[model samples]
Target: MTAAVSSAALPALLGPHCTVDPDRLRRYEIPERGEPGKASGLVVPQTEAEVASLLATCSKNGVKLVISAGRTGLVEAQRPDGEVVLSLEKLDQPLSFATPDGEVFRFGERAAPAAHADALAAWWRGIGAPPCEDAVLEVQAGMAVDAVNLLLAPLNLMWPMEMGSSSAASVGGCIANASAGANAVCYGTAAHLAIQAFGYSGDGREVLSDAPAWKAVPEDLLAINSAQPRPEWGLIGTQGVLGVITRAKIRAYAIPGQREAALIPVSDMPAAMRIHAAARALFGDDVEEFEFIGKPALELVRDLKGDAFRSPLARHDAPYYLLLQVKSHKAHIDLAGMLYEFLADAVSLPEDQIGYAPLKALKEIRHSITEASNARMRALGGGRLSFDTATPVAVFGDYLKVLEAELKAEYPDMALIAFGHAGVGGAHLHILGSKDAPVARHAKALVKIVFDVTQDFGGTFSAEHGVGTKWGDEFIARAPAEVRAALIAAKRRHDPAGTLSPRSFALDRQLAG
Candidate 1:
């Protein structure tokens, strides 16, 4: 039998950290699309003990939980549908940085390192890294990605992941989603950066990458001695179905010394691909980010930002635009000069059509595409059907062309806006329908069209945003048999009772069958 908790009994059971108040509960209800979720209560657990206790109670009673941090997820994973919301926001603090050998640097009382040169040097040496080289950070899961970078900024280091929602995306959420951003082409995804994770399994057992007893050892000697591989490796991209990540160690990199960016108008996807290839050939690893923006998406940005947002390109009528950025850590490297030289020599665009801008300005325009698309949908009194899809880089240009053609032909009234990490063959496609033909009415058909094409091109249906409840059914039905079986087996092994994120990927339904 499924267990149910009463609102009145929550406070008595979970202490002062639990709340059933509607107003407070509303904060965690907001979802990216569809109706906002409703929950019985919200629980804020500050430590691993509290999280484990709550999970134990839920496991024993068969009450469901939805793990949430930052509430910035695009997928419906965080949206609690009558289940209790277990929030890790209270655990938002840097714990300690430990090397592979177990040397720990505690950031007690202060989240960031001391500002003095001596203190900074001490931190660098403690991690056994040269000044401004690579390092690792141990932080609570609730800590925001942007906050992590802020703490590392003083040390001339960074976590290196860039998300449109970095300011609100939590460390745990990034790991759960295995998120990749525009710069993922250069730095890789969250799974690549995370070294170790500490969390509670769905059954309330302590699941840690390192030894629990290591905490009692001298701080200098706290290292991993386990003969078995870290169990947290399986939990990284599982989206909290297996466990709730409380703490993690993530790799950090020194800030690049020279960074340069350019925005160039292109005739179409093929032209954009040509320029992308040329940039990769010329700069190699120095090519940090290469992004594509459809004309409709660019127009939305220009219209929404109004007169202040002028197009960098001479003409705004181009079917596509490419935003290219290159960076180098070597202080003396002339990245801007080399980038300009490449543009002049390889790009066939007229001098007027090619435009250069600061990296920050160019990223701002790229990041604003989602906001603009949402605004357009809202204005039209219709909802949006957004997709995070990817294909092999070799056929990425052709894939987009086919997708655009199929989408326009089937749903001509729907405005198709496209943009994403072109360097990595990932794209975010949004379809906004007119009031006369609402997208909500054609949601399933639209999804089928996109997913079918994605399969044809040998691409992923859900690339970085994970398959939450929104796409769970499709994932189960359409994902390869082997992949589905593997995920199901993992889910069964880690969360047999389906106590955590029961709705995600419809694990409960799959298990029931």
Candidate 2:
């Protein structure tokens, strides 16, 4: 049964509203686990003082705590194992703005521009919430992400975070998981977006907020970044274990007036690489996205999404089709034209043949194709596989070849889909259909094979996705001995109790005592 913290530790702090609710316990459970339940019990604290008091109580009472956000995490950060969850659900706020003397609150700590954006995102996407001018918004840890994005529409502002599960994810949840999405190539991830945050130790006795520690971040992020390490605040990837983020400020961008999307003909591998090279040179950071799907992927997109799925290659015999987009009128049309020229010159593919479908239709094509492909793969029964990895941007084509060769050698019968942001060198390599052989043996062996190749290439095992519970052993096994030790030491110094998602990594050796 799920239980709350000991009354003896700090009964005065809890009062009446703090008592654990019976139904709330079920909310924390991993519904996917069903019978083999993981997390249970949840604590809802309305204020930072309450959060601190809760943590202090939990620590004093020898209890472990896991921060719960939107619960949409794919790697299962919130996948609990009977821990008492500190649900930031109650920490909600209304829309307020940051004018010169902007609205500020002394909740856990004053929110920053970064946190304001995150709250803004969560506001638009949640419930009846809609974005208002100079909106000052705050969120509890558990608000769903889609709910937040929905609210953002009215304000003409948008959170850069765009995950597949955004409809059900939370702003705070995405940050807690340090999440990323397909659009990350252009915008980066949660870590980059988060500007300021307030963190508290399990016992609430310890508190950390970047607001006080963080010096002013510039409207020109580049200028601020040039100074390196923002003289004031510590990095945030290690924030959770270092301290729990109760509230945060995040980076946000103006909503694009209209998006331009098209499919360009990539005649061959070299031609595809050239397009990316030229595109990057011209668009620089504004290049929202550029991904190449092999002929096989396009065939799938066509077969699954039907005739609406058109590509620049009319014959469907080309080597690849690159998904292209030019976001906002602020984007340079000349750059897009240059990219078109690069593709045409590199591989004699005429620009006319590399025609584009408009942005609105392009949206349907991408969304429809991806969803359909996923459905088709799952429908075949249960053996669909996926591997996401990163390689250096220049050697991306070479990396794709290596990945294809290795996978083909292992399972000739399966279908492989090469999709993801080539700009970031991260590709989603999906394996559709199962091999005639056993999955665990083949799948595990395949992962090992790919992991070794990636490591050899000086590429990281994880680019966007952090090493969670499932990847712990693999992550430790992959890292150099010293690196692992340093990570462990850091975690201990920040969280000596192993309180923040204790199983995040296997720290039993250093933290076991």
TM-score for each model:
0.90, 0.76
Clashes per candidate, residues 3 or more apart or on different chains: 1, 33
- Per-residue alpha-carbon lDDT of candidate 2 for residues 1-513, written as tens digits (9 for 90 to 100): 124444333234444444345465666766321122354456677776777766666655566666666554434456667666666766643234332234343333445434655664454455443333334344544445555455455567666676556666656656644455656566665655555655675445454444322222221121111101121233245425445766666544667655655677665655677777776665666667766667776677678756556544457676666776656544445544655565567546565766666555554555554566666665665365555676666666777777678878877777777666665666666666653443444677777877777666556555554555555666567766765666677666656666667766555443663
Q: What are the lDDT figures for the candidates, one per model?
A: 0.78, 0.57
lDDT of 1 by residue, 272-351 (tens): 88887788778877788888999999999998899878556767888888889888877887777787878887785577
Which candidate gets the maximum lDDT versus the true structure?
Answer: 1
Off by over 4 Å in 2: 1-27, 31-36, 90-95, 99-149, 205-235, 256-258, 267-271, 294-319, 328-348, 351-355, 364-370, 433-435
Model 1 TM-score on a 0 to 1 scale: 0.90
User: Which portions of model 1 show Cα errors greater than 4 Å?
Assistant: 98-104, 110-130, 209-232
Q: Local error of candidate 1 at 158, Å?
A: 0.8
Report each candidate's C-alpha RMSD, comma-separated, in the order given: 6.8, 7.1
Mark the 10 consecutive residues where model 2 has the least summed lDDT: 222-231
